[model samples]
Target: MQPTEQPTKTESLKVAVVGTGYVGMGTAVMLASLGHQVVGIDIDQNKIEMLRRGELPIYEPGLEDLLRASQERLRWTGDYASAIPDADVIFICVGTPPLPSGQPNLRYVAEAAQSVARNLNGKLQVVVNKSTVPVGTGDWVSRILEDHALDYSAGRYVVVSNPEFLREGTALHDSLYPDRIVLGSSSPEGIERLRQLYQPLLEQTFTPPEGMPRPANYTLPELVTTSLSSAEMIKYAANAFLALKISFANEIAGLCECVDADIEQVTHGIGCDQRIGHRFLSAGAGWGGSCFGKDTAALINTGSEYGYTMPILRAAVEVNQRQRHLVISKLQRHLHRLQGKRVAVLGMAFKPNTDDLRDAPAHDCIARLMDLGAKVTVHDPVAMPHARREWAHLTYDEAPTAEAALRGADAVILMTEWDEYRALDWDQAVRTMRRRLIIDTRNVLQQLPQHSTVEQVGRTTLHNVPGNEVLAEALA
Candidate 1:
């Protein structure tokens, strides 16, 4: 095999990103915007074609415009043979969905690594694992590469772990204006190469794209350079801690419901402490999405596999799952016999701004309501198609208006905190409902609606109270 030249730190090197999922696409665009030539490869030819046509398959705010702007520097292809061999850096941002046993299904990641190895052109490319996988996956990919490498040359390539910390709705924003950049590798050269790749982002040197503007006081994100295992574990541990905070808040919210203390005030008091900080403390439906549940379960499962049990993560998962049913509990108390009752759950997507319905709280809540024989109708501004595919049995409001879903409904539960829901004209919508009742899980609508009885998650007023049990008296 002929020796290939490596890139200098100042050079705009060729970059290849595998899998065009949320993480992959965002990373590719962000890198291209930073002046690196990026070739985004995916197995799905349709997705690649969509990207080629300047049509973004997934929905993230300002991602379409950013993709359009990056077209000059970024190319989309379905062929790994062409994309992998020439790149100076390869980011494996494929999906690592959890298995039945809570271990990550690394089939996609393994396939990507094997193919990258098979297409090795003796380049000193750094293969960075951006997928949130179990700890030690960097070494795992390194071994797989050695087994499948056609060149059989040492020092030609190195594996690094660079886990992504992107939220779904604000993925593009998160990638562009990151809080921190984490790179994990043992090899100094590999680490240096990856660092060079992310140096622009770490330094906040790039001009902001049109739709994605930089914050006025935006500081360059802290760069955390560490071992492969620590990087891998950081992604899991960070997500677990956030999920734990949310679940703990909900647990307190449940106690608040019992004792009639205002959970909003409680969480506010908790957030007032300088040590706790004020983020992820909102008491709401529950934490859901691609990361939280899957990663926490994987962390717990990984610990169990090594003869250690993670009670905190396990309890976090339990609390999040139970938080969904609490909505059902409220519904049961509100309307005792759910049999033949009409119910509508507003906002079907896990969180607002994205159509990703994987492990959404609406799934568990609506299922419980339906199990109690209540006819459940669901509404979401964007997730209807995906929701229909996931829950085909449930009635969906095909119309563009939320009123179509709320018309003559027994009760409405706000699950996802969507802008559309917050902007709704409840004045007229309440007139169409059979009973003007709302179970607001997201805490978006603060004021009392006219001609409606509303029960929010964290507020002082508990639902279905007896005559003598007022909120203030119970709190006292």
Candidate 2:
């Protein structure tokens, strides 16, 4: 069969996206909204039912409305067999979480591939690995499929490595207007088939969002055909570079503290250089999303496998780990002793806009403070429930607002850079708290109020009180 001609925007193809987590759900909703019939399969029945009712299993800004509108073209199922056989293209978006030793466990991907292979009776199907896997994962998936079934060459079943780069909050928007779509496949037929799958997106035929520029039709670049190994490397390299930028800024922030130089101004001056663009230069409590840490570490481990060392990448990881300690040190300076000091943590989620709290620096900060004997009360706009479940020993505030968490607190530490916390009424919170002390880890307070006291890591001075005299006095 001549590879099906690249379909027009109106022409829809059957697409199956396995795993209904953030990446999978966003992909399914976006493709369905673009006119393709999408079946989102997951083992979790609860998640499937939630998606069936147009409810998003995760908290994303514009996802629920898009899912609701695209309900006609989208379906959710817990049964993988029912979804995989009819799918012209199957996207595996399952998690590839890191083990304790920092190696990616590809158990989910292997299982998904085996399931797809078992159900493939004799139809042509393109399997796209949307999850960020280690190098040569596409070949591993192909091998697993071959082992599961009768003799099948690369023609009947094609595995493509197409990594996703959607941010948690703006996943749908990013999908609709991707910076670029990368399709990594060696087989000519596989490349052509995947191109046809994403042709609607490339042709700019989907309805453009209001006030957004219509995407120009750029001739699709031959699907970026390459060996499976190179394709896997592309995903890791991109994320590692971004993570490196963030760590570099934080390291500069430390320098700013030592020399009393403003890191923000320094970043602004350096960012003007076009070669060093100002993307992830904002210094804060470091990156704690699902992608950067895991992908970067996987890259480092992959280096170990090849008998090479990623010294800079390893330093990036160390700098990120020390960032949380920097916040704790600032707190220690203020209270003199963490024991018996009430620390109100302002945010629990990693960054903002979404409810995911995986590997949040706030957890590290809280645990350290607790170990030092600080009473912790935490609050988040949407992540309170998750935090409560994760850190059950800590106190939780029912009020969704920040002030409620600040009430009766000795000091407040801003961990996550949430917009709501940035817009907090400083004066009111200061009046309510026992001590007017704050450790703005995110450097988001804009201007410190004159009536209140505030100290930012790598910015403010911890003077006026005894350096270690306060702690000595407490001990005496």
How do all models score by TM-score?
A: 0.93, 0.91
lDDT of 2 at 179: 65
Off by over 4 Å in 2: 1-10, 209-223, 393-399, 462-476
By summed lDDT, the worst window of 10 consecutive residues in model 1 runs over 1-10
Q: Please provide, for model 2 over 1-476, each residue's C-alpha lDDT reduced to its tens digit, 9 standing for 90 to 100.
A: 12223445456789999999989988898888888899999999988888777788678887787788889999899887788878888999999999977899899999888888887756788899999999888988988888885556657888888888787776766776666677788777777777777776665566654444444553333345667778888889989999999999999999998987777778889999999998888888888979999998898998899999999999999999988788888777768887887789988888788888888898888888878988878788888876667668654344557887788889999988888887877767768888878888877876454345566655645322335453333222
Worst 10 residues of 2 by lDDT: 467-476
The true-versus-predicted C-alpha distance at residue 64 of model 2, in Å, is 0.6
State the lDDT at 326 in candidate 1. 80
Clash count, one per candidate: 0, 0
Candidate 1 per-residue lDDT, tens place, 407-468, comes to 87999899998988888888778789999789889877754455666777766543333343
